[model samples]
Target: MRQTLLATSLLGLSAIMPAYAADYVIDTEKAHAFIDFRIQHLGYSWMSGRFNDFSGTFSYDAEKPEASKVDVDIDVTSVDTNFAERDKHLRERFLETDKFPKASFKSTSFKQQDDGSLMVTGDFTLHGVTHELSFPVQKVGEGADPWGGYRAGFVGETEFTISDYGINVDMLGPSSQVVYLTLSIEGIKQ
Candidate 1:
């Protein structure tokens, strides 16, 4: 009878224990992740570009999603707009890649919405400046891959003015003040 009572108590304690969050590495090796951006060009058209190198990781807890976290590092010199001259100008004049060759984002909070989406807030550091940014992230899916690896994917979008990160916006014209960023991340469970 004593053994039965002890087992029952242990089981009850286990039920109240918090669930462990799963850690995942962003799948940059397989090119399953991207950090893309778009900005207005002379108020005439949208200029699109992407950073070719970046890495990140995330921790997710299905039972307590609010406790999830993410951290990412980007190679600012890897910005590619498809035009060599323009890309050079961006790296030299605007981003000043030689002085600030890296950018990063560290999530501060994650709030789950009623629609099953998440509102992610983080400190984004770019060009040596740090700012608080928030964006909504939608989970694309999560499942096991054919390679026997589990994966999860999400897409998030946010926009900010170039001046916010210490980049000059006057040269690009008023319409190009803000740059829109899109992050498509697929992570493999570790």
Candidate 2:
């Protein structure tokens, strides 16, 4: 019958079409995300800090992980090192927060690895300079919430030298040249 043939054709078309990717907003209002950094302090210890203000969005397709994309913007002036004096020095001399108030990352590609993690490559802008950076990101989890909402979480870590972004690394000492950054993101489905 024509009805049966139409039904079969519709089902075939649906199977061939790509699944819709979900768009999510980073849950900053709930404080469920964080951007943290750590760097060696004079070759003896590590200094840890975090940025308090940031927002981002991401689109993820479970069926097509390679099509995922992410974009984040951070308020550079929101850096907190837990030390007022050191934080002030960092804002003024190191980061020059007044001159460059924002840093951002926009993903260019997301490649799924054999281990199920993603190798994310993107353009990272910091201190008025942009560079291509790549890092491994792992999906922590994704599911429906008790409150009738959906959420997904991911964590990624990468390191870069301060001098690469035009920041003066002399004061940080030789051992403190590189800064390690960690991004813990939890996004609510939009």
Candidate 3:
């Protein structure tokens, strides 16, 4: 009878506790990040480019926003535009990825906004320059996957000028260009 009571108490405690703790680290294989940008092509038409290889991790708990944190890293040399010539020019001249291979972001805090979304304000580094950036983020949803891993998804977007990153513009023949970044990060809770 005593063994049965102890087992019951342990089961009750397990039920009350989360399957995974809030400190659960994010698994990057189940995540994604995309950067979208447009630049004028000799004042004719706009050219769009995107980077392909990027990685990030986040610890999120809806009940504990204060404990949430995120860190992201983007490979600047992975810039792609579907054109080899243009991509080559961008990596060699525009972004200078050889000198600055990776851009990163580390969040200072996460706040819940009026609309029930989240705002992550952090220092974003690009081209060896650091800039303050705040992005609006929404928790898409969380659920169990058929493969038996838990998943959480989020969406965030932010925009800034290319010149802010110290990139030369004479090649593009413009003083500045609007660079837009969109993040869709999905994490698998281990």
Candidate 4:
């Protein structure tokens, strides 16, 4: 929620002003923030997985939405697809987790769209390659928690291809190269 600051006037009137922005750190353990993805499998079904470990921090300003910032760090080896053998293949052959164990995102700019959604442009790093990318993020909601802390949530959606990051997809054969992602994030007010 946005808090309005009051600017007093000599006329006994008051003016509303933008609330100062605050930094919010992701309480990964409590928030259950997750990085989930879906990709075509065998040309007949969609394979889904999620990274179980990640952390991030972001600043939010409801009154000045453009001033928001975001940064995330993902543990590549934490990828979980529910199958032990497949997970091993993803870590060893596909991701090469030994050489590049981390993936990350750093925001460059924030833009609010006409539809009240946000366009976050940032550098996304995966498989040791970094590239500029933009994605849509929507504020889920914000409120006080039972623990006396305030939390805010957002959902982000983006897509990319393994080829774009120099990952070999020979095993997939004719499967779709694109990987679709759905990100759920919750930040606790610091």
In terms of lDDT, model 4 sits at 0.88
- Model 3 lDDT tens row, 1-190: 9999999999999989864334334454543445566666766777877777777778888876656788888898988899999899888887898899999989998888999889899999999999999988998888887888788888888888878889756755652376767777777775
C-alpha positional error of residue 127 in candidate 1 after TM-score superposition, expressed in Å:
0.6
- Badly placed stretches (over 4 Å) of model 4 are 1-19
State each model's CA lDDT, in order. Answer: 0.95, 0.95, 0.79, 0.88
Native-to-model Cα distance after best TM-score fit, residue 166 in candidate 2, in Å: 0.4
Q: What CA RMSD would you report for each candidate? A: 1.5, 1.2, 3.8, 5.0
lDDT of 4 by residue, 13-52 (tens): 4234446677888878864588999889878899999999
lDDT of 2 by residue, 1-190 (tens): 9999999999999999878789999999989999999999989999999999999999998888899999999999999999999989899999999999999999999999999999999999999999999999999999999889999999999999888999974875898989999999999999
Pairs clashing within candidate 2: none
> Who is ahead in TM-score, 2 or 3?
2
Candidate 2: what lDDT?
Answer: 0.95
Least accurate 10 contiguous residues by lDDT in model 2: 168-177
For model 1, residues 36-127, the per-residue Cα lDDT tens digits are 99999989999999999999999887779898899999999999999999999999999999999999999999999999999999999999
Which model, 1 or 4, shows the larger lDDT? 1
In terms of TM-score, which candidate is stronger, 1 or 2? 2
